[model samples]
Target: MKLVVRVKLLPTPLQAAALEATLHACNEAATWAASVAFENETRRPLELRKHTYAEIRERWGLGAQAAQHAIKKTCDAYTTLKANLRNGRYGRPSSRRHARASGKPVVFRPQAAQPYDDRMLSWQHQAHTVSIWTTAGRLKGVAFTGQAEQLEVLAAHRKGESDLLFRDGKWFLIATCEIPEGDLNTHPDGFLGVDLGIVNIAATSDGERHSGRRINRKREQDRKLRSKLQKKNTKSAKRRAKKHAGKEARRNKDINHKISRRIVAEAERTGRGIALETLTGIRERARLRKPQRTTLHSWPFAQLGSFIAYKAKKAGVPVVYVDPAYTSQECSQCHHTARGNRPSQAVFACRVCGFVDHADHNASHNIRQRGWMVWVCGAQSTAPELNLIA
Candidate 1:
């Protein structure tokens, strides 16, 4: 499995200036390269390099490695754009958003991230410093800091290109670390089904709930404050808004990390596999009122699921995705499915059996049952002899 370890870079004023210049130059070169690629209908990095390599090196005064990376990044941007278009992320081809996206060459931000390979960047883990290439010259002994665990991981497993990015008036490097996975737990005792929701955040079949009430309140407050700032529309207000940007996202991500860690640890301890809902196309499929729409759209259900998945992987615990279509409506006790099963937001009352339970808890049990069936079927399919007997 590949993980990213991001560390904050501390540089002298001179070093910062050089880095700033280098980033700007690389992005400028990339923007020009994109235009050339668009005009010639050439997006392949190798073929596009033939047209823009010499010019970028000479015009931007960038080193050979820097020039190559800039061109590659440009091609990568176009590739991503093309994929988005194919996926209809911008809507139909007749839509204005789609037309606007496909009509022009891609542009790079002034402080866009630039990739640095071994030749362009080297780290001194023990010394807590890095020697990186800059347009001015090669910078040596530039300090960097990160969490102790992350620093250790970077030192041990860091490989491939690192991206230097400037964000929120800070310099950072995102390094890719390729960590080997351990043996997977194929034979599990049972599946720990987890139900993801906007209110509860995550509810497991084991009756554990990680509440999101406090976080949702904070988000509402932030939204209100942001609305006021936008209405004010002053320079200072704008500055403050920019300063606070991503704060909510960071908080949500941290909370998700803690919740996922606990869930994975519990599953590993019990020798249980994790079962989650297959939430693909949820956004498009969901319908909600105006007020509820924001809450639903802003919810980080996918991030939580992904975190649980990767953490479970690292712990050698297996994970399965179950179809969640009527899990909330189906009675876990009687297997009766109907819209009336959920008499309230949080309560599940079966119409036929008169059995009652927490809505999420009942749903999780249904998910657990489905997960077990899927696992059994899959196991049988893998063994043809067992399949023939069945």
Candidate 2:
């Protein structure tokens, strides 16, 4: 598993200026290289190497590796643009043409974070300092501070390339570390089913529910705050609003992390895999009414699912996705399929079998059953067996 640990850097005034200058020069070179590469139709690094690598190095006064990394980054941007164009991802020519145009690329804060290899960056644990290469030459013993877990990762498994980023008036070194995968555990008791919904963020087949009412209330408050801020139309008001946005986002993400951790721990303790609904294109397919569209779009289902997946993987817990079609409408008790089975958002009652339960709870049970059929019964069936009804 690969994880990034961000450490705060405390550089001297001179070192900070040097770092900023180096980033400015590097990004300027990158923008120039990107324009040239786009014009000459050069997409490959090797192709750029043969044509313009040395020229850029000499012209920009950058070190050899720094120049090469910048050009490679530009090539990557162009590759993505071309791929998107080919796939018809962009609707407007203004967007497409702007992406492909040989215009000067925006250099926000001088693109100040340069990629660091082993040659360019080193860390000292005892002294709590890092040595990094800069345009002004070698910068050694730059002090840094981080949490214990972040420090531990740097001490142990820090590998590959790290990036030096300057943001919010502080310098940070983002280190990428590789951790070994865990052993897989057998789930003899079958899977723990999880149903994701708007009202309750997640409900397990075992009747555990994580309610989203608090999140919904917070979002509504944020929406009202944003509306008031937008009316001000002043620079400071906009800045304050942006700051609030970041705080809210971090809070939501932290909640998701905690929830995912608990869910994964439960699965691991019980020796069970997790079963989830495959919700690809759910927004477009659901055809939600106007009043519900905003809430639905802002639900963050994908983010929550991703958090669960990565945490599960780290703990060696298996996760499976079942087709979501009719999962809510189908009866978990007697396999009865009818739209009327789910008469309300919060309730599910089967007309045929007289079964009643919480809507999300019932859906989770159906999801677990489908997962069992796929994994154990050697059937690729998504639909519930209707034989019981007849």
Q: Can you give the lDDT of residue 302 in candidate 1?
A: 78
What tens digits encode model 2's per-residue C-alpha lDDT throughout 1-390?
676778899999999998898888878887777767756777788887677788878887888888888877777777777676666566455675645542443232475567778888889988999998888999999999988876886789777888889877789988887766566655437888899887888999989999988888888788788989999979999898877866666677777777788888998898888888887877876766786677788777777787777677667877778888999999999999999998889999999989999999999999998877766754321221110000
Measured by lDDT, the strongest candidate is 1
- Superposed by TM-score, candidate 1 places the C-alpha of residue 210 at a distance from the truth, in angstroms, of 1.2
Question: Roughly what TM-score does model 2 have, to 2 decimal places?
Answer: 0.88
Q: List the residue pairs that clash in candidate 1.
A: none
Worst 10-residue lDDT window for candidate 2 reads 381-390
Task: Report lDDT (CA) for all predictions.
Answer: 0.87, 0.78
Q: In model 1, where do residues sit more than 4 Å from their true spots?
A: 379-390
- Score every model by TM-score: 0.96, 0.88
| lDDT per residue as tens, model 1, 50-149 | 9999999999999999999999999999999999999998999999999999999999999999999999999999999999998899999999998898
- After TM-score superposition, what is the CA distance of residue 71 in candidate 1 from its true location, in Å? 1.2
